[model samples]
Structures are given as structure tokens and as C-alpha cells.
Target: MKVLHIIPSVAKVRGGPSKAVIEMVKALRSQNVDAEIVTTNDNGKDLLDVPLDILTDRLEEYGNVPIRFFSRFSPNLNAVREFAYSGALTAWLWQHITDYDIIHVHAIFSYASTIAMAIARIKNVPYINRPLGQLCEWSLQQSKLRKQIYLNIIERSNLLHSQSLHFTAEQEREEFHQLGLNIPNFVLPHGVHIPEPIPDAQDKLRQILQIPHQIPIILFMSRIHPKKGLEYLIPALSKFQDSNFAFVIAGNGESDYMNQIQDLLEKHRISDRTHLVGFVNGETKNLYLQGADLFVLTSHSENFGIAVIESLAAGTPVLITNGVAISPMVKEQDLGYVAQLDSEAIASTIQEFFEHPQVAKQKGDRAQQYIAEHYSWAKIAHSLINIYAKYAKYTKL
Candidate 1:
């Protein structure tokens, strides 16, 4: 069966939804399924340069899957108006979409998903919806009024009539139920790309990032957003100041939010203790993980903390808030600590890691083993192919 996977953009920095779709396409093709990715990216660009470029690279190895990037026409107000009024964009999409037996659309709350759903319905083709993290309560709460309007006006039909809906975790499914929208749902966590053996580069990596070897480093490698709760992270680090543990905030986002974080660090007089490297990917990203003594994600809400798994794969212990979906896994594997999303809880948890060196090391080792065995993308892809097959049968497309 042929499959078409649609995403807003394949830009890795856009976060997990794009990466999840790329991984899905790669996995489907590996099983000899005819799969092609249709993204709203312009042509003549190198996909490998994108973060989560692994998908593009892996697809090349198979030489069977086709990835096509169509030029996006003013994806803002102009694009919306044209797609809604002219029908040119949607008509073009309908023609191309008919070539595939089924389409899987990722990220529900974007113009991309909306258009794809409309085209699928017009063309009478089977389509599956993967909400990514949109179903999470935190996501809806971020802009409930706007989303509720869209749901009532545009997305309700799409969500109800789709062949199936995919979710990454059970928490996401539970959150969807709380939203009072009942649709057929499937829970599939985004698979982690297990890296090659990480070399012993503690000293080299520290020098590269200009981090002092003497100071312990806590790594936070997500986009700089308020939902990520860095507002609490910076001040909390100052509360129980560890003379040795420094903070490194990587990843990028809205410039104003980033400046606000920098301002907080400076205000706390611990600016020297914090490093803002601004979005590192590939080997540079892995190096930071290797150099870190501990990994921490203090987000107020997280669907499935991708960086948390990355820390585990890098053999670094992670300390996360209970709000993260994978907290149970971290606790079950004895990988790291999980605490509440408060300053005291974050500070106390970090303090315990430094206080118990032996136990901490053991936990870190378990973290590595747990990720390698369970979170591998190869295994994840296999599971996803099964899901696709089930939906294809039901749709009979």
C-alpha cells in the first residue's frame, strides 16, 4: 500500500511533530511499503541540513521512498484566504494526493493540517490524523478560545470522520478525552534515534562549549518557551547555588522570550553560571549531552520529552518534573529523579544528585540501557508500520 505523510514543515527546530512524521515515513518505507512525504517546504533545499535530518539521510539509503517539498504560498493570511476562497492550493493538493492510497497528517492546529484535511475530504481519499501533542491539556489551555473556535468551525468534522487518530502517549489520549472530543485514537510514542556509541569526550566537549571542567553542568536542550518553564529554572538554580553545577540553556525560540531569560539570569547575578549557545544540532548537540553531568527538563507540561530520552541515550541521568509523560519511565528504570514543577522540588532534586554520587552514576548507567533497549527508532518504526497496516485495512483504500 502507498502512504502519504504530511507535516507543516520538516524543520527540526520546529520540534517533535515534524521529526515524528519524518521518522514515520522512514519506517514505513523500510518495510517495503510505498511511502512518500509531502511537506510544504520549497524545493532545491537540502533536507539533511535540517535538524532531525536523520530521516532524510535514511530515506536516501532505501532509494524507494519519494519525498516531495511543494512551495508554500504565503502560509499566513494570504495563504489562508487563497486556500479558502480561490481553491487553487487545495485543488493542487487534491490532484497530488490522489496518487497515494492513504495520507497521514501531523499536527492538527495548523493551516497545513486544515488544508490537507479539506483536500482529503474533497478527493474522497482515506486519511489519518496524528495530533502530535495538540491533544495535551496544556496545549489547548495555551489558546483555548482560538482552538475551540477552530474545532467548532473547521476541525470537528476532520477529527470525527478521519480513519483513525494517532497520539504519542497515554497522557495525550487522556487529555483528548478531557477535551470532550471522541475519536478513534492510537497511542504511539515517538521513537528515539539511537546514536552510535558516544565516545569518551568529557574534556574535549567541555572545551568546545567553553564550559569549565571543574564545574558540574546541568543541561537544558529544548526551545526557549515559557511553557518550558525556564522562568522557574533560572531562579531555582540560584536558590541552592551549587558552586560547581553550571547551567547551559541551548535551543532557540522567540527572541523576546530568549532575552527575558537572559535578563533573569543577569538579574540573579548568576549570568556567568549560565550559557546560552542558541540551537545546537548534530554532533555539537550530542557533545553537550556527553559533557553534561545531569540533564534536566523543568517544563510545566511535556508530551513525551524527546530530550529526556536523548539524555538517557547519552548515558546521562535526567531530572524531570512529574508533568513530563516519561516521568514514569524514568522512575521505573531508576534512570533519574522526577519531581513537581516547583522551585523547591527542582532544587532539592538536583541537590540529591550531587549529594549521592554513587547512586547517581548507577542511575545514569541504567538510563542509557533503558533508552537503548526500548526507545530505538528501528523498533518504533516497526510498530508504526503495523498501525498503518491496520488503518489501511479498515479504510480499504
Candidate 2:
């Protein structure tokens, strides 16, 4: 199958969706499917420093999947920020969209997704849309008026005409259903790739934090955004003022907002205990995940918690909020703790975990086994192939 996955950009700064699409395509390729991705060099606050208008070896180290990067149109900052406007990408899709058997567009409210869906329909090529939680209730409320107008006039028709929709979680699909567009969608969560153990990961992390081995590392590895609920996490963690745990903040975001969060940590009198490691990837990221005593993400809205599952797959325990779609699974499978959105509730869970840290580590065995059996990209890619074949045939092109 010649499948083309369309997304604005695979920049890690865009958070989970961007990262997810890259792995998704890599998994499909491993199954011997001719899967490719077409995206812009949009890294937010900076364009990706890569060769444009062609597939590059930029991400070959991360995953060998082929990706064609188009130049992002940036005369108007608003257009780039809100829409990720790229006339170059739009024109390319218009010309080559039908070359693929099927198109899988990720996210709505973006130039890449909106234009691809429209062009796919015009060329009579079947397409699938992964809303990436844009149609969910909380997402709709942001820039409410602008999105409502866009949906009614453009995206809604594109969605109704698509062959099918793909949602990563049942909750994501159900929430999109509430929008009442009545499109066909299947729930298929993103798959996890297990990390190999780093022998000195524990010691490496402690050394980086400049702390002793006895000090427990409580990690928050994700994009530093308001949506991450750091407002709740910092205050909750501040309650641990005298505790021996070292809170490590990973990932990066806008400077102003990042400064504001740092201020919050200082105001709560926990800055001394906090270690800010701005953005991490590759082995550095793995070291932190593997070495952490506990991982946490208290997101106010998350379609799926890729980081949470990855932590478990890396043999670490996680503590997450019910706002994360995977919380129920984490709770049911005994993978980790699930706390209410309230700060007190989140703090309470952390306190309990610290009191019985061994119990949390014991759950690592179940967590690793569960992720291995259930969240393999190989299994997921086969299932998605069945869906694609139904609409695109074995080799539609």
C-alpha cells in the first residue's frame, strides 16, 4: 500500500501528535507498507534547519522513515502560527495527492490537514483524518469563534466526505461524536516503542541533577505548556518542600510562558528543589525516563498519554491525571496512579507513592508486560492496513 501521512510538521515542540505521526509511519514501513509523510519544516519559533522540497536524512537517526519537508509560508505570522500556512505544500498535494493509494491527514485547524482533505476529495482519492483531538470539547473552546466559523464553512464538509476518521482513544472519538458531525471513526490508540535499558542511566541522571543517589528523581518529561497542568503540579509538589525528591522538568515551549512557570516554582518555594532541563531527546531522554523514581504528567487535556505508556515500557512507574485519556487503562492494568485534576488529589497520590515506592516499582513488571503485549506498533500497523485496504485496495494507485 502506498500510504501518505499528511501533517503540519513532525516537530517535537508540537507535542505528542507530531511525535506520534513519525512513529506511526515508521511502524507502517516496518510492516512493508510504502508509507511516507509530507510535512513542513515548521519547528515553531524557528523553521527546521533542513533541506526543503525533498525528503531529507534529517530524521534518519530517530527513524528511517522517508519524509518530504516543504517550506512553510511565513509572510504573515498569524497565518504561520494559527494555520501553519504553506502554499508550497498545498501546491505539491494538489499535484501529487493521487499518487498514493490513500491519504491520512493528522489534525484539523491546520493548513496541511484542511487542504489535503479538500484536495483528496477533489481527486477522488480516499482519505482518513485523525483529528488529533482538535474536535474535542476543550480544544474547540480555544479561539472558539474562529474555529466554529472554519468548521461550518470548510473542515466540516471535508470531514463528512472523508472515507473514515481515526481517533487514538474511545474518549477522543466520543467527544468528537458530540460535535454531531456523524462521521465514521474507529478507536486505535498510538503504539509504544520499548526503550532498551541504559546500564548507568540511574547514575547518569543523578550526576546531571548534581544530587546524591539517595535523592529520588520525580520527572515531568513533556512540552512545557499551560495545558500540561504545571500550575497544579508545582503547587502540589511544593507541599513536598522538605522531601528528599528532586523534581526534574524536561521539554520546552514559548519563552514567556516557560518563564511564568519557572516563576510559579520559585513563588511556591520549590525552585531550590527543582531542576530544569530544557528539552530532551534520543539517549538523553531515555536516560531520564529509565532513571526516574517516578514520572508524572498532570495534563488538563490529553488525547492520549504517550509519555506515560513510554515510561512504563521503560520500566518506570507513572502518575497521571484523569484528564489524560489513558488514565483508566493505567488504573485498571495497575500500571500507575490516576489522580483527580485537583492539586490536593494529585499531591495525595504522590505522597502515597513515596511512602510505598517499592509497590510502585513492583507494578513496573506488570506495566512492561502489558505494554509489550498490547501496544506494539506491529499489531497496530496490521490493523490499520485492514482499514486502508478496505478503502484503497491493495495497491490503489
lDDT of 2 by residue, 1-397 (tens): 7999999988878988888888998888888888899998888877887778887545663376798989887654655465788888988999998888999999998998899999998999999999888888878988899999999999999999998999888777778878878788899988988888899888988988899998889999999988899999999998988788899999998899999998999899999889899888888999999999899999887888888889999989999998888888898889889999889999999999889989999887689889999999888888998889888835442
lDDT of 1 by residue, 1-397 (tens): 8787877666555665556666667776677777777665421122233222112434442233466544455444533522322233355576777877778888787766788888888788778898866778788786789888988899999888798888776776777788787678887777777666557657776776676776677889987778888777777788755467678888887667778888899887778877888888778888888778888899877778888888888888988887788888788778999988988878888789878867877888888888888878778877777777776634342
lDDT (Cα atoms) of all candidates against the true structure:
0.73, 0.88
TM-score of 2: 0.96
Q: What is the TM-score (0 to 1) of candidate 1?
A: 0.88
User: How many Å off is the CA of 212 in candidate 1?
Assistant: 3.9
Instruction: Quote each prediction's TM-score.
Output: 0.88, 0.96
Q: Give the RMSD in angstroms, all C-alphas superposed, for model 1.
A: 4.4
- Candidate 2, residue 143: CA error in Å? 1.2
Name the regions of candidate 2 deviating beyond 4 angstroms: 393-397
User: Candidate 2 — which pairs collide?
Assistant: none
